[model samples]
Target: MFGLGPAAKSLREQEEQAITVPASKLLLRAVLNLVVAWFVFDEARGPMAWIVVQFKPSLATSVESSDTVNVVMNLLYYGPVALLIAWFFGRMGRWPLVWRRYGRPLVRRVVDAIGSRSGAGTPGKAPTGAKAQGEVVVDPWWAFRPLVGHGGLALLDQETAAGRVGDVDHQRLNRALECVRDYPDRLAALLDAVREHGAAACAHPSGTRDLPGRHSGRHDLLLRQVRLGSAEDVPKNPAAYRGVDLAIDPALLGTSLLAVGPAGTGKTRRLARPLAEALCLQALAGTAVVVVVGAADADLGPAEWYDVVVAPGDPASRYGLDLYGGARRLEEAVARLADALLPEELAPRAESARQALQQVVVPYTEAYGRPPGLRELALLLRGEPVAWDALREALRAGGGLTDHQYELAQRERMHGQVDDPGALLADRLSLLDRPALAASFNRTSERGGGERGGGRGAGRPGAELPLFAMHALDHPLRVRIAVPEHSHPEAARIIARLAVGQFLYAASTRQDRSLFAGLVVDDASAVIDVHSVRSLQRLRGAHAGAALLLRTLMDLPESLRTPLFGAVGGRMAFPGIAPWDGKLFAEAWGTVWVDERDVTRAPDTSGGIIKRSWRAVRTILAGERAQTESVTTRRVERRRWSPSDLAQVLPGGHAVLSLTAVDGTPVPPLLLDLQG
Candidate 1:
């Protein structure tokens, strides 16, 4: 019999047996052929034998006599066939192998067709009327639905019952919904609730409400919200409950920020401090450079990451910024210094001072290979004989001037064109001659060198870094120019303007957009002008911005206020705002048509006999019988937020923000709470 041996003891034993006693190729082929032949013969025999059996019954009368010899032969032929069939069955049974290969694939195709028709398992495409993710779909009937019973709250419970909403507090949803339920007319409140809570909370049984946080988290930078408006407005809008979020991108800052409010209204703590802290974080990460200009008494908090503090004209200050440093050329450097020193009010003197400084700066820079310090420049501008001798000697030693040029410079010095403009220039220059101020401008050595050097060229204690050496777009630097305007108003303005000019020059020179640079003027009223406004407008492409703070727009010149208002992309008007300033914001925000209704009462005389009799019978109707009603309606245009409303209706911690949208449209004024 052809039968397999018993199973091997192990996999290794099986391998060994197969290697030692492999089956013959011809014998295995013959066995396979015999197995196939037996199967075919057995299948055909079943039908043939059935037919023979049917005929045998009919022809069986002579069966015993006829089949005696045939019976033996037939039995002999059928015996081997039956034995072969049994052997084949014992070795290998007939099974359909085709179904194993194709069954799963065929069933999958049918399932896929059914799924496509029934719209199952497709994630990318939405149903016919369904909204895409992040899109707001509002219901028209949302305003009419009650927030509690059969409205948003009920819908939330329904969704929760269906197991849709997840990981949210049901109690909080119900509370928030109930809070805003009465103000169904305020769609924004309902929408904001849905956004903060879940869609289920904003879903009414009849429809779903979708509200997006458009100005919320739409940018990388954000200002905290303390409150929305008044306590009464809380139930009317979600902005009051959750507070309104202020989103202003650092890039748009070039358009500038103007914050107007009273002194104690959280302008510094809520607005300036928070913004400065955000910039400080960026500076620590090496993405931005910040310069904060404020009064010496202003509290900017502890900024440990700040790289430099340039408090010029301060007795206790560590370093000073070179008024003429960081310019691309000596002319530009001289022009910036001249602008800072000569106030715009002294136009003629400013021109002469600019010319005189330029005349000396060209030769002095050529002679010494670096621009002169403020004191040195002042001495050259004086044009005295002794100063000329010192300058000629310095120039001769450096071999910067020819004989004719030296003689020409000497003649010009004698002619007095280089003389100081007046007492004002001299006084301004005197402030720069202070030891601390001089030492700050001296960059020749590490620490202003020694006492006789007046700390000039000697670096400060830990690491003496100059403010001009810090590039706004490339380095991580925090510069605070704290000059008390009360003690030295002129000097404070000079240093502030110098810092502003230096920042503008450095930012404009940037070729790549890798860093966000900002200049924050705590009291912008002292430094803002046409030049600064133009610089603000031009610095947008260089990734630089300015945040200007003021007590009021009245602090600015009447002519400059309009330009400043138009130039800034963001404006925040706090309470105690003046009516004139409020008007400015009102116009910027534009107007809308509001419908007004008027009702009047008059005497009525016309009536039928039955009506007169009824009126006479009822004593209560006697007064109403002579009464008539008349109604009048009209549409009137009004400012969105009138000046009176802004000055009076706005709460202490709240502000009205007139911000520019990312798409350049004006966003309707938003009432925001700084402390919320």
Candidate 2:
């Protein structure tokens, strides 16, 4: 009012405008802030977040700890006020949230605004020269038209180029290319052209036939010859070449081979090398290498049972063998196999035996007991004769006894009483006749050690099974005996028969192809019948290969004869003099045999001198014995074996295996012992 200048007038006008803000807009903003503050305060109400603060007491005040409550209450009162202010300004505007509801419309508005300023107009439309900002727009050419009509844009081309491979377009192309019917010649021509072009381009054949050194779409077959020990020391090696090594690819083979020979012939030693090689392979690849033992051979006292014999630095030992490790492995495999095969039906019987042994013999031994003889035990065990040698083996193996504990206990029992040796032995055997009692005795013997410092209660209650468990991948059964033990030799035969039979079964049962691991059964005349050898043809049909070892070719029936002779894969013959045996083997082994007349022709030839030389040679050869060979054969002329056949006669250091061979060839005795 004091000045009339233009500047004064403008200032008055600005103040009037500033005072004219509408009450409605203010109310709306206040309501919005209040609403947002309510939510924030409500979320933070339950727990007051604590903050540590140190303050100097009011200098004029004498502060008491009890006065701290008033200060804390004051701080809490300001918390809600600070929270409300922060919520109103810091985040209230965030509720506009076009992203949650009106996102598309908001985006459209912003885009349109930008387009208008840049002279580009809206998107998806043709550019309008400089006014359009050079941005090409896609026109809705089909707009204003009903659903069915064609559009001006080249849609098919765009769709095809951007579509997935082998899409509808690709399928259509394939159908056109493959369209063939109504013209045989055209199809043939097309095939011929394809063959010319595709064949020329291919690096390998697509045919199923195998072409060595070239890829023929056939899987490769590997033949692994696993040697247990150095072949150079074959004579000193027993169990050296147990068979082929476990290096055998699981993809190619399912079984291995074992060639056993007579005692002092290094049969067991020879098996060792291959067995070791197999173990190494199995360990590295997590593969399984299984070796089944013949019951007869197991019954004998193989060096494998005597850990001390195979220990390092033993003079008589051929090589330091890890007997304990080997036994453990073998036992583990057998036990696993048994778990799978021992049927529920047999469980009760086995358990009964176990309980009897535990309750009767174990407690008796714990109180007042002594080791009994095998004969008396046999009488007690249902009058069935128990193998004395087997009992000895059990003792030696520490089946239920410490290394020498059983022997010492027995000695003490027999200490002073010496009346009727036979009666005494019989009575002792009868006392142990109960299988349960024997089992218990074994347990007590193994654990008790005559109660003299030996902890009879220490060992686990279960019987130390004769056979061990197999690894997971191997067959659940390590070995199966199919003979009635009515005859000692027959029982031995049954044990030996399972070895090769198992191999053949494994290889022959392939789902698709034959496992190329060949089976070898040496000395095929001792236990097996000659006619059974021909039954091995089933194996051939199954695509598996086999080699039969024999001392005489004639030992096998004529029906089982093969033109390949022994040359099919592998063959070997020891020097022998049985004329018929020699002739038969000469044919089978692929070696030429000279008659006495032929040798006398030169210094290495003819007549009386030749005859004498031939006889001498035969003598040298006859000095050695033969063993049973396991072979696969068909069921023909199958004779039912009597119970007598189940009786087993095991040699001290060796076992004899008897089985029906594929061809009617007698099984050669298979003599095997544990290697040192």
Best by TM-score: 1
Off by over 4 Å in 2: 1-223, 227-263, 271-288, 294-490, 499-503, 510-568, 576-579, 589-676
**Residue 110 miss distance in model 1 (angstroms):** 54
Candidate 1 Cα outliers beyond 4 Å, as residue runs: 1-243, 313-316, 347-349, 403-424, 444-467, 470-472, 599-631, 661-665
Best by lDDT: 1
lDDT (tens digit, per residue) of candidate 1 on 35-145 = 665667768676655565686654434444677845764565466767676555322321111222245668888999998888764443335565778988643234335
Candidate 2 lDDT, 1-676, residue by residue in tens: 1223456534544444434445454345445555656665666543333232224334214223446765665456447666666554433333332233346678889999997898655443433346446766542212212322343123432332343211212222222234443466754553443334321211111111111232111111212234221122111112233231212232222212223233343333333323322322222221222332322222222333211111111123221111011112323212222222222233333333333222222322322233322323323223223433444455555454454455334433432454312233334234333342233223233432222110012223343212111111132111112122223443233223333433444444445341133333333332233212333445545544443444344544554335323213222222222344333333442222111111112132335876767655433332212223343433333212211221222223332222222333322222234231
- Each candidate structure's TM-score, on Cα atoms with residue i matched to residue i, is 0.57, 0.25
Backbone clashes counted, model 2: 107
